[model samples]
Target: MDKLKPFPAVPSDGKIETIPFLKACRSVVKLLETFGPVLMPAVDDIHGNVKKLEKIYMENQTEFKYLNGMLLEEKRKMGCHARIALLWLRRGLELFFVLFSKVVEQHAAGKVLQDLRPLIKQAYEETLEKFHGYRTKQMCMGLMEKFRKYKDFLQIMGANDERSESSVFTILPVYLDGIKCSTEAIYNRMVKKNQVEKHIDDAETEKTLTQRELDKIKVEELQMLQTEEKKASQDQCI
Candidate 1:
């Protein structure tokens, strides 16, 4: 019989290169940061429009009561005259337009907010998944290292001892559990860091409304208020 050729020895110094998923993750994170601020104005604008509509609706309700009171007093004094017709026409149009405008504005705002919701959720999930993926890769690398070391130790301990196999079987589960625990801890830390970073970013951006933008919003609001007041006063006069 031919002599059995010895198998080539495995290189002990072989190095495995880890996947660079973290670099891709960092790029995604940077993208999220850049686009996140761009979306904020749209969000804030929608919110402001909603609040403005609500305020206008409430004001219209109050004005409706006042108009009704005025109409009642006019009817009592005038005693069934055509002046009531003009009064109702003017006041009624004002109230109708106010309600109509509020409805229209609110509808528009709701549509914009709805469109943004999906984008926000996607960005959040992408960041979360990337973080999880990085942690998993790290844990896998650590487990592989432990596996290599354990195998080497077992080889050095020799093949005849049944106790070594038994010990390995018992300890393997613990090693796996430790890796799992480590992954969980890393995942939790990443999540906490994301949350804290988000909080800080939100806080910093909260006061980022530019003076020009704020002034423009204020002017538009004042113009609307003035227009409404003028219309109401004109109705009361006639």
Candidate 2:
């Protein structure tokens, strides 16, 4: 059988791919930074439009309410009444469009936030290899720097510092949980592997003991047979 060789040592930090993945994750987050600011302005614009439409609606209502009944009746008796009907229809359409725009903007913003969560999660996971075996200070300081720098993206993603359940801010805990669970799984597997090795060692020891016993039994039988042959030869001589 070939002699067993020792396996190569793994780096304390991680494999060669760890650094590349970390860089990739950083790049992804950086790309997201530009997007959040862009979408925020769109949402603000929608709200502004809503306010303008609301002002127009209120002004139209007030104008109609203040109209003299006699003038209104005179206008109603003529074809000029169609102007009021048209104004009401126009206001209704504007209100509907304003409300619809708000809803659409909200849905778009929400979708962006939802999409950001998975990207954040993936980046967090990618950092795990590099983070492994790091001192608490090193890890915390490094990640904190990143958090501070990219904080705007968080706000843009609708994940502010507030720990709202619907906000992407809550996803931070999910990243932590993933790291913890994966570490525990690795540790558990190592324990099981050690247990398996110990059982194999015990079996090898038992086999050695059984083999030694069998060899001793065979030697004793051979000695008895040789002695019997010697005694029978002497008896034949006599």
Candidate 3:
């Protein structure tokens, strides 16, 4: 049998050549191997001339911006909602530090039965209203959930007197750090979502208006009326 001809070798960085179906299939497979993972998610999101996830992300950002600005102003004005939020966060931090100190004391000075009645009572009272306020506002639900977890931990550890050197006092700081990070993330996301939505809405409105068409119509009508008036005036003069 005669030897089959070798396919032409295309340059590595050049445009792909049009070829027979089988060869094209091989080229597509090679391209997929090269870039599938990098391109798949983007293409999937952009399928059928729709970018649903992108639109959702943009709208959320727009709504978030407006909410964030309003919240900031409310905080500045010492609004009840803002006050409650600040108090809730501050109380959480204070509780963590106080509990941590108590753990340290139990380890070092052998003071295990020291009363934390007043501090815990105060934290509960101050934060109860704030928690309720957050629930009402529909803000900080995620923070509240994390706060509940910390509260449960504190309750479980509240009565324990024996403190091992390897106890998880460090975890208190980690919990507080997580709360701070989550709160900040929520705030930033809300602000960005609000801003993006507002911009999208404004763009859509502007797109629907045709200023050039309206102006041209008005000018043409005025010119036609002016021409009739000029002819009438000439007739009267004659």
The most accurate candidate by TM-score is: 3
lDDT of model 2, residue 133 = 32
Q: Could you tell me the lDDT of residue 136 within candidate 2?
A: 32
Q: Candidate 1 clash total? A: 0
Rank candidates by TM-score, best first.
3, 2, 1
Ranking by lDDT: 3, 2, 1
Question: Least accurate stretch of 10 residues (summed lDDT) in model 3?
Answer: 1-10
CA lDDT for candidate 3: 0.33
Which residue segments of model 3 deviate by more than 4 Å?
1-70, 73-80, 108-110, 114-165, 173-238
Segments in model 1 whose C-alpha atoms lie over 4 Å from true places: 1-160, 191-238
- Each model's lDDT: 0.31, 0.33, 0.33
Better of 1 and 2 by lDDT: 2
Q: Write the per-residue lDDT of candidate 1 for residues 141-175, one digit (tens) a residue.
A: 33323222223333432423667645544443433
**Residue 102 in candidate 3 has what lDDT?**
47
Please write out the lDDT profile of model 3 over residues 157-215, one tens digit for every residue.
44243252234454444433443443333334332322222221221232354666434
Considering every candidate listed, which one attains the maximal lDDT?
Answer: 3
Candidate 1 residue-wise lDDT at 121: 35
